[model samples]
Target: MDDESWALSPNARKPLPELIEDKIRALITNGTFRAGDRLPTEPELAQKMAVARSSLRTALQRLQLQGVVEVMRGRGWYVRSTDVAERDEPLRFDRRVSDSDLLEVRIALETTAASLAALRASQGELDDIAKLAKLHQAASVNDKDELLRTDEDFHAAVVRASHNELLDQLYRSLVPQLRSYRRNSYSSAEVHVRSANDHNQVSWFLRRRDEAGARAAMTTHLLGLYNDLAAQTGMPVEERAGLTNYALEDEPSWQQNR
Candidate 1:
């Protein structure tokens, strides 16, 4: 298909990148693009969509994050999968799993990853995690995109530092859903600052090779998120009680604040 056939409307209610993402998915659904099909070059896509190359790149990145498409180094973007709808099935918020349920799984995966990272992460990985932590901590509340990106990067770096390929892969698989969860969860500047501080605490423990401290820090970080989500979702008292029963030496600061 030619680039002309992919032109998007000039007037769009949604963000340009989001509209472009939907259009691409529609094309894929209609069989215009399939697995292994190379998408047009960025310039071509930009021209056809009447958007800047940056916007086109943003849409493509979001698709890549969702596992619908992937970019090959020095090549072009290609359709990675056509089963986009099914890809997010298991973690679909409120449908397949509650938001709290997702965080519960994250708590399990990330706390252990943090502990392993403290023991196994090399100096270079530890430095990267520290750098990302600082960046996320310094992100401006006014810039939600940067804040979100930095937050995701910090966590991913921590997971990567685990040096466990399977653990990293599992965390990567949850990126899209977690990204969605984060978008809805960042309700205030206070929340952002608290999260950034949590990242710093995680990095601090990892740098010192404090396995127990790293695990506890990660637990505190995610438990704050879990509590917030539970409150907002009106999670059942019994369910909330079950999920919040983690053993710790001291009360989490967030809980103390409340």
Candidate 2:
């Protein structure tokens, strides 16, 4: 907002408040307003848009309610990296990253990616995802390495099906950390059950083209993983009741369609 050259369009026929909200949403989606980036002060943005501060605040409040941005009292508003509120210390960029932090990033990335994939994936893409899930499900858990590799492949296929190049690149960059988590997760039998059930459910959701269900499946999968990792390290695991409902229904699409 502060001299950032984000001036609102002057010719819009829509309501001023709505126009302001659209502009902000566009800026955030286009990467101009990044996670944790403080917005321009109310006066500055109002001047830039040539709108009253009251209208601007209304637009911002709408964004806030939508979880697109957050307002910090006495400090100002900032864009959220994820749909949920961010931690006081956002994930760091340095190499000293924790496993829990990497899992957080994975949840944020994969959940949205799955939602988009359910809506946009081609039939062939869904086939690829189903094939990968089958491979993971059929693999021998005793061969931990193979099981883990197939699990990673299934997740990679899901990410590819999302068709978001930037998100794909970011997911690829997190491979090392993901591999670390996978290695630890494979040691537990419960983890294998969680992965198989969740991956199968994910593939089923994709075939059904259920965006919300797909996102929920991926979130549940990763949260299960987070729990597995936490238990291994003796940390308290998160409650799982909310996002853990779906499973591979009898004769899921993957099996019926195959």
Candidate 3:
């Protein structure tokens, strides 16, 4: 493969890791790499692609998550599959599933996960959750990628703390789509601050083992995002009216005992 030829475009708006992912995927599509082929070592690929090793690792991880590649311990990354139709499945799913649909799924899964985490998380798990939450809160508002990465980490930590392997797997499956949604949805510093605050609130509840409070906080966080996405997409008022109704009727009860 001609690594230099895969260099990212100067005008691209996607994050460096995502751009690198695209380049690697293009390599696969063009038959430069094939199933079971060992990719160049991380250092070589990083230098050739003009990306940091960390960014390259991130791209490789995302590809692994999408079933396009895999990493062999002490060996190197390898192309796991090169079926164009199979690789495009996620993109097709994304196009069919709207942001609101994703958020609704998140609300269901994460709220329950948060509740379980509050009840089941060990001291060490709780500490990890708190640490990730703090990292997210302290992330620079000017750095969207940092904010997004931290945000994803915090949520994943909470899900892991739930100690439910099945839930963790399901959440991991949505990660690539969630990453894309977060990238496009972070429109301002205010939104970042709001998210950080919500995370803090959720962390606090988890620390106290307050299941209801944790569930409520996660629900509120996701619903707020849902409302924002609905507005941005110009969703019909009738369709959006339920969001307002749910918040008005249920959110306060959750917070009242917090």
Candidate 2: tens digits of C-alpha lDDT, residues 1-258 = 354456766755788877888788777767777889998889978888788987897677546534467555457888955333231122247578777667777888899899899999999789878887888888887877668667766777788779896786567567545665676568756767778888999999999999888988888788777666666677643332123332664111211111
In candidate 2, stretches whose alpha carbon ends up further than 4 angstroms from where it belongs are 1-92, 236-258
Best-to-worst ranking by lDDT: 3, 1, 2
List all candidate RMSDs to the true structure. Answer: 6.6, 17.1, 7.6
lDDT, residue 23, model 2: 82
Worst 10 residues of 1 by lDDT: 249-258
Every candidate's lDDT: 0.78, 0.72, 0.79
TM-score of each: 0.65, 0.55, 0.66
lDDT of 2 at 199: 95
What are the clash counts of all predictions, listed in order?
0, 0, 0
lDDT accuracy of residue 144 in candidate 2: 71
- Which numbered prediction scores highest in TM-score against the true structure? 3
